[model samples]
Target: MRIIHVAVIAMLVFAAAYVYRIKMESTVRTEKVLQLHAEVRKEREAIAQLRAEWAKLDAPGRLQGLAERHLKLKPINARQFDQLKNLPERPPSIVNPGDPDPIASMIEKIDPDIITGSLPVPEAAH
Candidate 1:
């Protein structure tokens, strides 16, 4: 009877120790999760701040002011417009008329069957 009592007490002590260890592990993991959540929140706030700064910098009024200060540009007037017919004739084509199409030539070189239509085409899926 005494031996049975001692064995039961030992088993109870081991179970208590195991439960305490598990609890400690759970607490540590919960703290780590909270720390990660805080870091993510800080990162999101930083990103929001950066986006706000970017929006301020890219505002049309601010950009227009910067452009006017840095770049010497004039507003358009009717005199600046010109008819297309008044323009000079374009330069002549550089390629020779006798030359074959470059893409066709490349296709013929890579696979003569493609140009000849000798390969079997796959049917489209329904």
Candidate 2:
């Protein structure tokens, strides 16, 4: 009877240790899940911040103001163009009308059967 009691006590102790180990492992897993969730939240916040900054930088009114302050530029008119008086004339084409078509010489140079007909393909030249 005393031996039976000792075995029962040992079994109870082992069962308690098993339950405690399982509880600790579940707690560790939950902590890891929370840490991953926090990291994802931080990344989402960074993306939102970057998008807001991009929106502000690309505003049209801000761009126009920057251009006016930095460039100090103006539009031109026909009055500015008319100020130029003595421009040179363009040269005429150098081709002579009496000359025959240049393509006729190239056609004479190339064999008609090579390009115009179904000829056997040659092997690699290299």
Candidate 3:
């Protein structure tokens, strides 16, 4: 009977120790979670501050002012353009008019059974 009492007391002590250890672990984890939350909040605040500074730096008025101060730019006028005859001749096209499109032929070659029908192509409005 005395040995059974000692065993029960030992079990009770072990259970108490286990519960204490679990409580301590939970407390430590809670503190770590709080620390992480603080870090995240601080990071968000820093990002907001950086964004505010970026807004100040990237303002259009400020950029235009800087450009006007440093860059010597003039507005475009009719005098800048040249006569149509003076301009270079247009480059020759890779595919001539009425010639089978090389791209379409290659795609047809990849799959012989592919319906190479006239797909509705968007034309440039003259």
Candidate 4:
């Protein structure tokens, strides 16, 4: 009889423990879901703010000002174009001193290992 009573008590304790574990797990999951939703809302707000800032930066008046300052320059007349066309072709003797010969020296200076897969390095300055 005593053994039967102890068995009933043990079963009751196990059932209580199972219910407690399930309740705790559900609470944790609900908290995690709330946190994820909050994070998504924050990211959406940030994206909206960035889009507004981009719109302000691309305003037409600001763009026009920037163009006038940097790239809106133009010649006054067709005479400048005629003068440019009248200029003589440069002689080969005046080859630019700053330019290097890619066909001759550059080809020879290339490392054979770089052409093959044996070397992992990018092409270095000659």
Q: Name the better of 3 and 4 by TM-score.
A: 3
TM-score (C-alpha) between model 4 and the true structure: 0.57
Better of 2 and 4 by lDDT: 2
Question: Lowest-lDDT window of 10 residues in candidate 4?
Answer: 90-99
Clashing pairs in 1: none
CA lDDT for candidate 2: 0.85
Task: Write candidate 3's Cα lDDT for 1-126 as tens digits.
Answer: 999999999999999999999999999999999999999999999999999999999999999999999999988999999999999999865544675787765555575555567886568999
Q: Please give the lDDT score for candidate 4.
A: 0.84
Evaluated with TM-score, which candidate comes out highest? 1
Using all chains and alpha carbons, the TM-scores for the candidates as numbered come to: 0.73, 0.55, 0.68, 0.57
Those runs of model 1 whose alpha carbons end farther than 4 Å from true positions after fitting are 94-126
Worst 10 residues of 1 by lDDT: 107-116
Q: What's the best-to-worst order under TM-score?
A: 1, 3, 4, 2
Error of 1 at 78 (Å): 1.3
- lDDT (CA) per prediction: 0.88, 0.85, 0.89, 0.84
